[model samples]
Target: MPESFPAQTSAEAAAEPTVLARIEGVVGRLTLNRPRAINALDLQMTGLLDDALDAWEHDDAVQVVVLDGAGERGLCAGGDVRSLYDRIVAGHPDETAVFFRAEYALNARLAEYPKPIVALADGITMGGGIGLASHAAIRVVTERSKLAMPETRIGFTPDVGGTWLLAHAPGHLGEYLGVTGTTMDAADAVFCGFADHLVPSDRLDALRAALAAGGDPEATVRGFAQAPGASTVEAARAWVDETFSADTLAEVEERLRAHTDPAASRALQTMGQLAPTGMAVTFEAVRRARALPDLRAALAQEYGLVMWFGRTQPDLVEGIRAQLVDKDRDPHWSPASLDDVDPATITGAFSDEPAVPLWD
Candidate 1:
């Protein structure tokens, strides 16, 4: 039997560690504990997760690992962009890079961990949340799960190696999802390769208990898995592929305008609300990532692009401010139209080296 449960003091939830760690029989569990913030990862949380994984990797007692979040909101909402914004506004934008270095490193670590890591991707999972779940060996999503990488809507391109996942998605779905930051339902997540099993939300507890009881990892989860039903997002595949497969963002916009599908028209309308620069760069990044050899290479590429955006003081700042800080939902994006974005600038991000290399 396990020595103790990893539960917080039921009456005093506020006192619990930001990351709650414990061993449940052979399963080592790590719970993101910032329920109020929806478990948005900060550098400290990354360190905790890294430390736990490192400890569990070589421990014979830990045959499996389960990652989850506290509270009803979701697994995670991504990195605390508001905290990132404060650092940028304070002229210490480089500090933001430190967080990404650690977070990206942790992400890569989880993907390649020796032991099977099962991620319970429930509730709101987006941005960094996807980083935690999408790469896991046994990614289990519940009906309540909401997945996305909504960086573009805030004028930032998707980071957290989202391009790699997005690039590998069916047809041009990557471009559509990456550039629009559209939310994905459980079925969409499974169909797009972002997730694996569609276990019902109610069964999650029993599933976790069975895994904790030392059941075979894959077989145990599979026992509880159910079909996720048809993906509403994939239903738009024909239009998505046609509109997003164009050679350039301009071509994509033109196609979106010309396509008769109301979804296409909706996508066109959505694009109008996004940062032109973000949309352009995201399209380039997804295409670039699809050609990269592996997740680490993609991370290295993403590290470069994100650093450039952070230091250059482009749309990311305004986007965060408008959408999050000010809550105005009105971002005055520079180079307001996609036509105004400099192709050279997009290409230059790919060529530039990060001041802090990711592996370092």
Candidate 2:
């Protein structure tokens, strides 16, 4: 956990509502309340958020929805992969499947929300955090913001419409970011279309006050928004494009190995540390997502991919155990290298399955 956020016992955290919703005049304020856990989304939080959104969507009294996190550390870190690992280990895959189903539905709903949604994406936001905030109408980030979709590090590809969002980012930046699990700052986020307005961290309270007082979200955000400094990703666009535009993961690795740029070398090092199978899957998924029509299509495909990985790959559990449980950085991925991953296995992972449907 980050030091900036308050800590809580698991029992205490579980007792509290994962999501807190209050009506402040016409603005509906929804806060992810588990600061101790970095407000990580669990199955229960997914349901609570979805239900709140559903009710607020039809309520005439609600003019806008402001989504934020409770702690100073930032918004959500991601989903509760620890719980997912436990359930899978106990031979209860259905539980994890249900979580993904509800979470994806929430993502889709936010993407199509009728009213404006102002997401205060402060601090560390990654994986499922991106799902929640990136889809919002008005994504507000601060200087403290650190955003990413780092599922590849945990033996999973980015889920919750990440493929759609990343695929549409400038150049092949999505490929580089997704595979490498690189974190980007507020400036990089705004440049890549992940965030809209960049507000200073200290001014967030005032911004929230304005929203609670029935101020227009856009105007208020604009009032507080400032330049996001320099965007490192923008500056490295040519390098990112050239290095990540290869036809396959192997080719991408070769290019990175040959490239003289220190950033490319660092990315290659990061990729080397991640689960090889996960990287291969992410590469193919992003490529496929680039050609997909919309969020729904990308999500549908991602649903199948996750289900397959959960059922067939040991890397998911090993990765989670290494990073979260054992605290050992070394994850013994089953297919330890990209060359060891079978193309047929990759094809099978993406194949259609009886996944919990995203939509009725």
Candidate 3:
């Protein structure tokens, strides 16, 4: 077990340490240690990370920071949405609001960190995971990497700076993957700009050791990034761009329905399984991010949407039940049809009424 630090407050002990921090050989490493929960960033983890990053920014000895996961399955599956849902059901919606405000602020800080940030995206990285990885200057991926922003599948649009990163993806690929929750390997991730380096999993320990030994971490990472690779996902670029070019989900669906390609058929099926409201919101968010001038503004906008979502929607709880609790692969979305999800509902999610401060 990792050595425990003195608890900041009695309430902190009631929850698990969301993150594990250590400094060795001029490298500051932060591991998302909640393995059983797939290293999801909960409230405590977000606060801990924010403090760690702020400290490291001023510590001259720490030349580089590496973010990794504790377990074999993933770096982070997503944020702890189930916890937020529980808070809502317990009639503490404000707790959910607190969670996003801190989480988004952390995302922004990482994006602008002065010191070099390297992310070891060895396995599953999605939703909140993308927020942590995409902002880093160097993102290393292994063959096991399975990266995505699968929020639409769970009745929520993507948060955690997903709006900005997804918008930065090549062409319409972002729209295709965001709506479909498509998972990709290291090669695909590198192609999509989510990863900068592709290292074999077996080589990670050696890489970490080299960094610890005062090796030029940035140079070492770049060498791996330039290693031989092919863009497998890029081959389907034309189809992805054309099919997702429609103005709305219905138009996109209509085009997909008309296409004869097997890939198009699969895309249609994936969309069919996701919540209509979630998909619509995701589509809009990505487009809006593309036009936004700054990352902070984009994250603030996401916080606005998430604040209302955690309190008002049952999709998050149902999604957690289907994906995590029971693993039943079935979710009963409240507004089952797209028609039931009116423009007003999506508009309401973007309100600034409950003015949440960006950082505490």
Candidate 4:
């Protein structure tokens, strides 16, 4: 077997670490080291990851890169939103903008990366985590993996190129998952096309060992998973497409509210519980993203909308407060109803204004 990634000489073990990196044979492994925060991707983590990926991309010896989280809680929860919330509380808008712009650029880079990338997502992947994993060439999920784009629940639309991924998810399942912040396990993720492979968590070590030994990374990963059955989400496709198939968010919600089907009823209840402005923005963003040429275009569009909504609107703060900050389960929404948002407001969110650049 070939030795650990020898492209970078600094693969030696370290005592104190921010993020972890090891070069084993042809694979460069990056582990998000902030286990205490469930491996949240702060600006520092994003920068480090981008830098490492850039290095690995050009280094011919590194044929692949592996991304995963540490300490077992999950892969990554996303940009440490609580920090962004604190910035908002401090009246610093540029802070959040800078963080997202850099992060989204990283996401776009990953999507367009030339080399093979594998993400072993084990648990609680959400928000920025979705950005990291969704763009990978190979995504592995385990029974412990719970994936979601839950920004709507936290008073933000799903950013980090979420609009792109959700727009492309099988059938209208993306629409349903995006709007509802629904959480799914490995099976559901594989069925919905979010995960490329589903392996038990216990098999990760062996799989990594094989990859480190210069095994065919792609086949090595596939070897761990059996062919999954048709997705449960796939079963709900007809109903999802019909109920969510509307030109506007208002009409979509109305259809959900009026429908008597059990699934529709449950959807309506979840919709009722979410922030009105967030729901409207999310639905609208996903719709607009579908027309974009590619993931980068979708991310750029989403980047513009989030800059406007995250800072100016009270929903982000209130949502974060209730969901993450205070954990009160009560968010006093500003408009209080989706109807309160006018057409101009939604249109303005999508305007191709002077958007913040992804890179300096």
Candidate 5:
């Protein structure tokens, strides 16, 4: 169960017309309104959410913030990666840098928020979406939830403080998930510490209403929460810990190939589809992040890696083109295989000229 917040007297609700903000009694409600795109976040939405959080930080009328998506598909799919692709291809690196800077800052703030934040992650929450919900005080998911940090498939390292979360997940499961871009269900999410409660999708509205009416949000969610059954990750815990525990990607691959489990076979198949260099970098990044002191430090390191990827890597562009723009599901990654990726190149991505500092 998540920690509860103190209740406060109801105040007249304030209407925020843009992006669906309304103060319901003492609970401040904010919705990601871009349903057509599964609420994939953009620069404008990130700024709006950051501004609202800043405003509500000290607003007595807003005792707790309830965040959700406007549509049924999910809370959010991710950041507007297509936009970043376009900007990068257009030689507008500054625009891409600005978006990442602001988005990462927002992620850091959520990690440190003083007030309790309740996020309803009922559907496809991946990448940037994880950034929004994973750091909250109360993260609610449903059986319908599908969560992942699948940046490796797009030739990107999992950003938005992903390395921080992945590094701290139990055992070496983080490496398996990060490198393979595995999508976990509700049970897996809770097992991995990515969510707090498992409320049924149908009960989300009632839960939201209870929160808005100044009822204890944590209690309401707990009341509706149900056991998520068994987690596949938990079932394969031993295999994951043993296979991914290898210090090098080569050793991990060797373990996977030698294992006869169906899961190992499936993981090996998935790895074949991802960008090899990206996977190598992701492995090193997560390994390094495990020793970092805090979320801010992890985000800073990710920013540096992403900027470096943009400047030197061709896989990101090729991966996005094949997966998104071309819809072909066939990315011809440069450096073709993990064995072809230079260890020095992977290290350089981590040590690239530092990005503009994320904080003072």
Candidate 6:
């Protein structure tokens, strides 16, 4: 039997559900159905996922869970940043708090879920998408996967437990990816601990069938997942660890410019295009998260930083406008260069607690 809960908030009565949850054999399947937005997680979608998880957790009949996206482009593009930007520009920035709090809470729930959740980290999984997939018990990546925590590009630091994961990545890759917003391929994802297995995109259907047919999730995955080739991240580890380990962003640039590797050159150019405040804050956030006790602590710290960005920083709104809303590729970042960002702003964002609670 199949169960589908169509979203009721839609003006059209016949609109398809943005989230589809059903049972096949002993497996519970959840799909993010908003292909048009590349399955971006909105408030409604988050709530629906939470509800489905609540039901599945207690259902003895449902033994395994599979989460995938509806579209070919990816599992999820990330959170609905444009919607948040719209609310901010409307003079009601506080309204965005509900979405962030709910989303973060949902992420925590996923991290601790009782059942084995097989998350298909295929295609463009970034920002909020990584939160959903990477925390799962069984994370699968494919050759088509393009994974990143690309918040800095839009003048935002990573959230949704992003810092916690970034902090825990191998060597100095966390710091490298955190500031530059670099995308990782399957091998890189596996090497960096973002994914557990690499399964070819063509074999995904067989993989899903094996899961639904009710075998051990791990064993079934082992049968289908092939070993990925050498990670470029691994190849560049000497320069990555050495350059990014510098105490200051200035030194990071100095080291990067000195390296002859084309990877180093590309990274420097990408960093130049990012918002300075975002780079400064994200660099600190990744380092701070590494020192924190756990994911919950990192999430709390990230929540405070997000509130700071929403309420006080001009770069967040400006960056979103240029990148998402206006389609203009240029964002005149506040303090425009890494050298101009105030050190106090970075410290204060991590220190101050938000008025809204993530949990009651």
> Which is the winner by lDDT between candidate 3 and candidate 5?
5
Each candidate's TM vs. the true structure?
Answer: 0.95, 0.95, 0.90, 0.92, 0.93, 0.95
Per-residue lDDT of model 5, residues 1-360, tens digit only? 000111111231123222577788788888987665677777888888888888899998898898899778888888877777797788765467888889899888887887889999989899999999998889999999999999988888899988899998899888988999899899999999899899999898888878777767678778889998999988888999989999899889999999989899889889988999989999999899999999999999999888887777889888777767776878899989999989999877877774465565
In candidate 2, which residue pairs clash?
none
Arranged by lDDT, best first: 1, 6, 2, 5, 4, 3
> Deviation in angstroms for 328 in model 4?
0.8
* Consecutive 10-residue window with the lowest summed lDDT within model 4: 1-10
Index of the highest-lDDT prediction: 1
Candidate 5 segments exceeding 4 Å error: 1-18
**Tens digits of lDDT, candidate 1, 1-360:** 000012233454457778988999999999999877778887888999998998898999999999999998788888878777888888988788889999899889999999999999998899988999899999999999999988887777788779999999999999999998888999999999999999998998999899999968999999999999999889999999988999999999999999999999998999999999888989999999999999999999888888888888468889887877777888899999999999998888789877778996
> Candidate 4: which stretches are off by over 4 Å?
1-15, 352-355
What value of lDDT does candidate 3 attain over all alpha carbons? 0.78
* Candidate 6 Cα outliers beyond 4 Å, as residue runs: 1-14
Model 4 TM-score, 2 decimals: 0.92
Q: RMSD of each candidate?
A: 4.8, 2.2, 4.5, 6.1, 6.6, 4.1
Q: Residue 283 of model 6: what lDDT?
A: 90
Query: For model 5, which pairs clash?
Result: none
For candidate 4, the per-residue lDDT at 205 reads 90
Better-scoring candidate (lDDT), 4 or 5: 5
Model 2 regions more than 4 Å off: 1-10
Where does candidate 3 stray beyond 4 Å? Answer: 1-18, 226-228
1-360: candidate 4 lDDT, tens digit per residue: 000011111332243364788798788999987666677777777888888887888898888888888877888877777777788889986667778888888898887888888898888888888899878999999878888888878777888888888888876777788888888777788877778998889999988878777767789898888665566677777778888888777888788877777888888889888888888888888888889998888878887777787657888888888877677889888788878877777777777453456545
